[model samples]
Target: MTRVMNAYYSNLIEGHNTRPRDIEAALAGRLDEVEDRPLAEEAAAHVRVQAWIDETSSRGDLPEPTSVAFICDLHRRFYDAMPEELRFTEHDGQRKEIIPGAFRAAGEEVSVGRHLPPSASRIPAFIDHFALRYRGLTSGPTGRILSIPAAHHRLNYIHPFLDGNGRVSRLMSHAMCQAAGIGGHGLWSISRGLARGLRDPAEYKEHMDAADQPRRGDRDGRGNLSLSTLTSFTGWFLTVMLDQIRFTEAMFDLNALQERYTRLIADLYPGKQRLPQLVAHVLRHGEMARGDARFVTGASERSARSDLGELISGGFLKSATPKGALRVAFPLDYRERLFPNLFTDAAPIVPAPPPPPPL
Candidate 1:
């Protein structure tokens, strides 16, 4: 139960004070956090981690600026469909805002202010290996939660998937943990860990600095990173991930939000066939509480309540009890998959860059 994964690569991490056992302990801790409240906000964090993991593990190379934009997209998508007001224009040259993802391609070598050389296109082939790598850590006969951090470091090293590399890389780590059962029926949200990592790359940059160094080559080695910095990055990253599992365990359960709504409307129309639809319409409109259910379903109040009530039973909509309000409730699994920062407000995640090129 305490198998440490990819331990030889410990040197790959920069400021590692944590042991393989420490990672194991963190995984167990994540489980305990959710046992008492299986479907609370905390569970949302676990789901969030898995979403990020899938995004990261699935892509390839990209330019630096593109990578940044890609990450912005992932964040936008992670939330519930996104409120129009939250959309920003400066994204991906798009006139509108959208979910962020990694670029997996090179960007303009220089901004308007600078005239850098034309950037090179990175290899996409690394994706196949990285994807296989995380799977090994997740499914092999001797798998462990440590793979979460390991995969993350490897993902960045590969630099697969352009724009959202950093965001997606962290997501991959969280996803690996969930698949590996590190969350114990819930999630350890490496994104939160990443939030911390982004807050301060110092400790993380210390880990795996050696491995991240630019490969010895002919050209383009001009501003490549050094081994020590890679090590620091690993330490800081793993430390942040360790902290994230604990933090995510304390958040609300995504299912609980929908269930409460379901229970409220179910009590109003126990035997209606169309309750589900009626409920869906009511919840969708948010402010349409006073409107007749017929507007939503072209049926009577009895018909509307019946359909909506059925939806309540089926978990499509929830009505306010004692207060008489209505709200939309997505499928539990759907909600978990889509809205990660459910309880938190939108805020930009800024990662600290590693110490400058080892002086």
Candidate 2:
């Protein structure tokens, strides 16, 4: 048996270079300025705070800070392909804005395993729920850590953005952790867990099932998400996040790497089957011949060709015709340098630095 598993997500946050790794690297490189990135840990932490603010909304007279305007602004500034200065401004005085229904792309989806289409009509309330659940405010707006999984369910239910809701939702979950002062900067990235969800739909379903229901028949038993469900969802959320932290701490964990690549690829191609693998094959040598993709995936040449064409259409793979040769190029995110040991052409892989040496 050719026991190959999906490795698409390995590069989203950090891990070995595989097909998905190349794609994510490619996406980030294109979206982010390559020359001078802020410090790694610092950038990651800043992203979590911005993400949390994006997911929350003023509710229960709690001075909710999660708003679509906030989200849009944060996204525009933090994740935009252009410079941060051009993307966002002094948010302190920006007018509150709604996440336009035009947030998702024409065929975008909330989950690769499911679809919760975006609707402007239903978004406001959904945004409210996101900030309130498990939120305990001390001085500022609603604040609390309700576990990443709980927030993920509500995020899907609302389906705020036209295109990047899932990306925002996942980021929002990490933000929840950051707000609790537990990490100040989120300690984990759920992009890895999403990859696990892709590999085991059953496990994913079981986990989501616990936290996807309504709480204690509130006001005529209408809502589906319950407090109990939230707690259950939160528990698993922490566990999975911790798993990712530990796996990375250990220097190398193939399972975690596989999880990252699968999730990253899925995020790119939501409903497309075997798309992540297709992405991986293309990056075997940092590029692929469209005609040879079939050999790598055992699919017909037509199918292989279609895969490349689709990736090109999806912005994951770029096409360039070099003198006398046709090549499909893969995106490279230099941040993968964070893990130096995973590639063939670069410097030798070194053991990742020890975890802060215990306090």
Candidate 3:
């Protein structure tokens, strides 16, 4: 669910307005032919790339986050899975094809607002400098975590790819967080933080632009870029990350979540008892064998099968096969009840305050 939300908001930054529910449907293999198919494909591709990053990071197999290979690979994996229409962008009034895993052609000048990305020819050397500077940070968690936003802004300034630079940068930030041991296992997303900050996308852009400025004065660091501005942005980025982590931790409190789960089961099936026990068992064990559902629910085999079928059909539980092990499924429809406020689109329901005494 967090990955799906990440995909939604990250693409939302690019002006692709795919809804959360639509992304959910796409993940379920239900594509809408008219309006959603394209956005759905794009969102699905983002999720896949994120999943790849997480897997690689967990195995300690990911390339240094700032390396040329990692950046190009992120671009390649995403675009290679994207549909043809999403792979091209206008450059110099002409539609240019984006080749997966390839850098922009030499002499290409891409404009991002007032900022002109470095000439494509300089990208490799710039990336080499990036890797050399940041690769050492990986040895320490504090350095690794602190470098995420700096790395994010630097990569965007380099603008190595023909397109999808923002998505790739965000994914690289996520990979860095994981490598730094702060990923929270996909329970929170910085993309949501970036999107929700100040309720304005332009603010995020302005921050990135500020970091792209040349060193302001003697007080600033000796680097070409404004270290002060970059530090400010990194501070904001770290705040966002911490806020997301704290928010998710509050939501995942086991007692509160179990209470909500019980209420949701009762609301979904008015007369069906013993469903909460079954859900609690799966939630505790992460998964349960089909034959064991009867034991957990304290119901006969026929009754257990019926309840399990109902839960699966309602998108609350999922199984590989009809009689296979079942795992809890927190699909988008149930997110509001199960994990409130996890997505920005679904505001948590709070009761209205009582009217104040008459003045």
lDDT top scorer: 3
lDDT of 3 by residue, 1-359 (tens): 77888998898888888877877777777776326787888998999889888878778787777777888888999998897788888989898999998888975779898889889998888888888888886678789888998899988998888888899999999888887888876666788778766345576787898888999898899988888888888877777677667666767777777788888999888978778888878887889998898888778999998888888888888988877889987766677788776665455443322221221
| TM values, all candidates | 0.37, 0.42, 0.90
For candidate 1, write residues 288-307 as lDDT tens digits: 46346677657776666555
lDDT of 3 at 86: 83
lDDT of 2 by residue, 1-359 (tens): 00001112322323222343323333345425322232222233234334344334212121222445545554444344322332322222552232323454333333433433445565556666555553433233332543446556666566666434444565555444444444323324555555554235244456665555556766423465466656665566666665555534542344444445556668767876666776555444556666666777787878877876776665556656532223333234522432332332244333332221111
What are the candidates' C-alpha RMSDs? 16.8, 17.9, 5.3
Better of 1 and 3 by lDDT: 3
Misplaced by over 4 Å in model 1 are 1-120, 141-144, 184-187, 197-202, 205-211, 214-236, 247-359
- Tell me the spans in candidate 2 whose CA falls farther than 4 Å from its real position: 1-21, 24-67, 74-119, 132-143, 181-187, 197-202, 214-224, 252-359
Task: For each candidate in the order shown, give its overall lDDT on alpha carbons.
Answer: 0.42, 0.46, 0.81
* Candidate 3 lDDT score at position 199: 41
Clashes of 1: 77
